[model samples]
Target: MCWCGIAVSQILAVRVDLWNNGNLVQDIFLGEIKVPVKVLRNDSFQAWYLLQPRENGNKSSKTDDLGSLRLNICYTEDCVLPSEYYTSLRNLLLKSSDVQPVSASAAYILSEVCRDKYDAVLPLVRLFLHHHKLVPFVAAVAELDLKDTQEANTIFRGNSLATRCVDEMMKIVGKHYLKVTLKPVIDEICESPKPCEIDPIKLREGDNVEINMENLRYYVDKVFREIVRSSISCPTLMCDVFYSLRHLAAKRFPNDPHVQYSAVSSFVFLRFFAVAVVSPHTFHLRPHHPDAQTSRTLTLISKAIQTLGSWGSLTKSKLSSFKETFMCEFFKTFQEEKFTESVKKFLDDVSSTESKEPSGVSEPVHLKEGEMYKRAQGRTRIGKKNFKKRWFCLTSREFTYHKQQDKEPIFTIPIKNILAVEKLDESSFNKKNMFQVLHGEKPLYIQANNCVEASEWIEALCRVTRCNQKRLSFYHPSAFLNGNWLCCKATTESTEGCARCTADVPADTQIEIDGDRETERIYSLFTINRSKLQKLEEACGSIAVYQGPRKEPDDYSNFTIEDSVATFHTLQQIIDIVEKLNESHEKYQKKRSSSAKYGSEENPIVGKVS
Candidate 1:
């Protein structure tokens, strides 16, 4: 679908056409755009151009006023660097689980730095989830977040890192669960469009409010039935995550047992299922975005689900969350206890990981794939000789790569046999941005075009294999060169690694996690944004000093700091640690430069030491 190697003078064009399924003129030419390529020195070009009418004299005149399409386009190109370049940053993030105060964690700091917290949250959640550190990490961060909140009703309300992580996790694991629960109903509603808008004032001409309410009731009933009945189909991973949240919430508020149910309901019902009801296209329940009327119908049904779910969380008989009068009256037709029991049963089924095996297997998911060069691994040779570009794919089940038109994989490594995936020493193959996958004593080396892809591949590979029982305690960070390991001085090829493994996942056949290294990663982030930290400290002081009536347009107003007193204390701890760490960082840098010229943090997460 992508075209390259075009001459500078060549033209780039886009022609829009209209297609009707059963019309006489099924295909009609609309407009065309022909632009001469320019600015060849730059990587991309972006601009809005006017659409010209069809050039042919054979065009019909019936569609003269079809209206123009509105679109905004942006073109960009990125040249990803070799993995060695980002080694310092990647290694820092791998240590995120260990950061104290949680806010100083690399993941949190990344969210702070980005314009949208969701952007940083997605990648960080995926990275940690793959490494078996998601639960503990999320617990620690959310615990700190809870401490900063004074309102019980609004707990975990914002799109904070913890909430966003859970959101992304559900999306990652619940693809099948969503399809099974909502696709059929969604397809029916979308295909057989209905006029279900119930607001009397907003109803269209000739629209009957009574008939619309009946239609609304029918759709809502169908969606609610699908949701409450399909609890068994809920994904195991999501259930596990929800179970963790339930326990965490109950422990936090032992006085109220309803908090336990509401915790799971807040996410499952409000965020996950109800949101899907409103936007089916986002969850892939629908192939295309719905029309305006369909969207309104979905929205009304979505609100009804939310209302019932919220009511299910409370013990009160009164249903009071409805914003519209008609909706309030309409919901009266249904019995509250009937749906409440259904909600309770669904929550119980999802949270129990007892009968069936937990759906924790992230297999068959396309973890990562791109075109990368692989060094020839042969029994006849002791070291690599040449590299060739091949399409590589790593999944939970296996790692495979193939050439174009290859029906089967040319090379594959079973996920179980993967012992250590570490950065390859540049000296071993005389090439930059290289990594090796160790299955047996003989490692398979691969080269990447740049540092980003190299880090991504290593992160993804390490994530899937974190739970493997046979992982190595120590691994050669580098490769064999001149009959000795490049990482260590040992001359024997079979000698153990000279450096200790840095990843938190254990090789001890037990699930062990290190949550302290995350702080070390945060120390680096603090260094990067030292000035911003200072400003935040000043804002904390200002908010503490003044407790007057509300004011806006100030440094303190820029943030959503819930418990300012608690946040101030946490910020002081972070600044103190950051300052102390920077002192040690300075001394370490001087020693490395003066005593050891070869040693560098540029090596991947594990295998290299300073």
Candidate 2:
């Protein structure tokens, strides 16, 4: 197309030839063809050619003849349209007097408009507010606009148009949008202050505000109710909104008890609601604003404690009882640190009093009935014993000791002082078999089983038992029967030695024998000189020779006399006088029998009669 006055770049040029009924009419320059411009839904423009002959040369202009022309044109640059056109269209519709009929179109256009141009449409926003209409459409537009602006982060500082646009946007978008964008706007308002103009009535009435406030509250309440219904749903969003409201309430209605109470009560209810809905394992999302979150938490804790303090008021109602119970638990968890300290101090006090007085003290710290304390006695380690005895004063109610100190005073305090007793599991606590030391043909209890329960038995053993860690030969009693002695070498290897010659005979001269033809017998023999016996008595205070069968008699016909005889004495004179002579044997037997019966009903023996 050719234009006489327009710039060449703006004109469309095309070559064309007209034909009718297979006959060429003429070759002609299409000459400034009027192209039909299309306005795209996105507000972009495109031009298409439709040719017609000049009016001077036209035979007759007819509608049917206009269809014969076909022309091709190319754009000089990229054809993508700018976004400002849509924004302008939106602004026009927003300002138009007849916005109701085309409200959907305006919203759609605004949503499609460039985020940066939202401020440009602020004048149009005033029309919506004045009419008190298009709240939903405006809300959608605002949300879409917010998403765009936040994504692009176009600076809006000192721009009155932008500030009003965002505020209106938040009003339409409801509390969720307000919560998400509040921090940024609050920060802006705090820094600049000029852009955020508070409406006095809206702040005072809150959700009850007229027109736009009602719609805003509806959406906001919907979001909150859903949050209350399930803590798992949008917990972070709920926490943020509640936290923001807490701050906003304080700022908007400072010193107003009613508003403060309403805001804090709502937050407390929401917190408890969340706790009820969420599983114990789920971690509650805290508000992003640390200071606001801390204030909210403290407020809830205080409320819970106060509720617990007045629990007696709720006795008549089921809901009140439930509330009181929840409050008690909440208070307990909230005051955990304080409670722990108090308990520790109480235990310490009891322990100190109990340990102050020794067991033998004539003037004991006497406590009244049900009032008790722990007193620790100084440990006395007698002789060469390694362990010290421990004592404790336990009230009937006391379950277990909590203090871990090695020498803690025996707590004579009431049983209630014990918080918990840790009973070692069977897997952890080792069980030892009990054994008894027997005299000749007489059973004597030596050690009791269940050492954990029998401290006295363990103490006796600890006092008397001496452990020789050095590797020594432990001869099996059956080894002597076969006329052979089993000796463990220094390397701890078992080796057989002729019983008659082995030097490692047990000091006890009594031997237990078993046979099929007779009952089990205790054989006593004089195996040591009087000097050795005297030395043993001096070292251990007293020495005894024990001889007995360990169990009922069994078959012994298969037993062979293996010519086994352990060395009774090292010197020939002592062996001959003690082992070979009948007189020495009778004397030894009489002495043993007398000593066994001395402490019993039998007559006591005097000195050893030679």
Instruction: Put down candidate 1 lDDT per residue, 1-610, tens digits, no spaces.
Output: 2111111222453333322324331223344444443332234444454544544565664334543443333443222233443344545565655765566555565666555676566666665754656777777766766666665556667777778888887776667678877999999999997889888877899999889988999998898888877654565456667777778777777787677777788788899999998889678787544666887789889888877776353333444555677877778877878888778777776665443211233336566788888877643344444667788987667888887434478978988788877777787767888888888747888888898888768766765665455777688877766666767768888898876454322111122333333334334455666776666656656666355544454755545454456555555655665666666666755765676545344321222111
| Backbone-clash count (model 1) | 15
Candidate 1: global Cα-lDDT? Answer: 0.65
Please give, for residues 1-610, the per-residue lDDT of candidate 2 as tens digits.
2222122223342233332323231122333344323211123334444555543566676534444433333332111122332233334344433333221232222322223435324434443433333343333333322332321112122233323443443233223222332233233322332211123322333323244323323322333333222221112212233333334444455564334223333323333322321211112122211122222233333343223222122233523454445343323323333323332232222112122221223553322121111112221211213222333223222211223433444333332222111111122112132222111211111112344433333222211111111212222222111222222222322442212211111112112221111100000112322443223222222111223232222322211111112111111222233333345435655765767666443433332111
Best-fitting candidate, scored by lDDT: 1
Instruction: State residue 388's C-alpha deviation in candidate 1, in Å.
Output: 43
- The parts of candidate 1 lying over 4 Å away from their true place are 1-88, 311-318, 356-610
Evaluate model 2: give its TM-score.
0.13
How much lDDT does each candidate structure score?
0.65, 0.28
- At residue 404, give the lDDT of candidate 2: 40
Could you tell me every candidate's TM-score relative to the true structure? Answer: 0.54, 0.13
What value does the lDDT take at residue 167 in candidate 2? 42
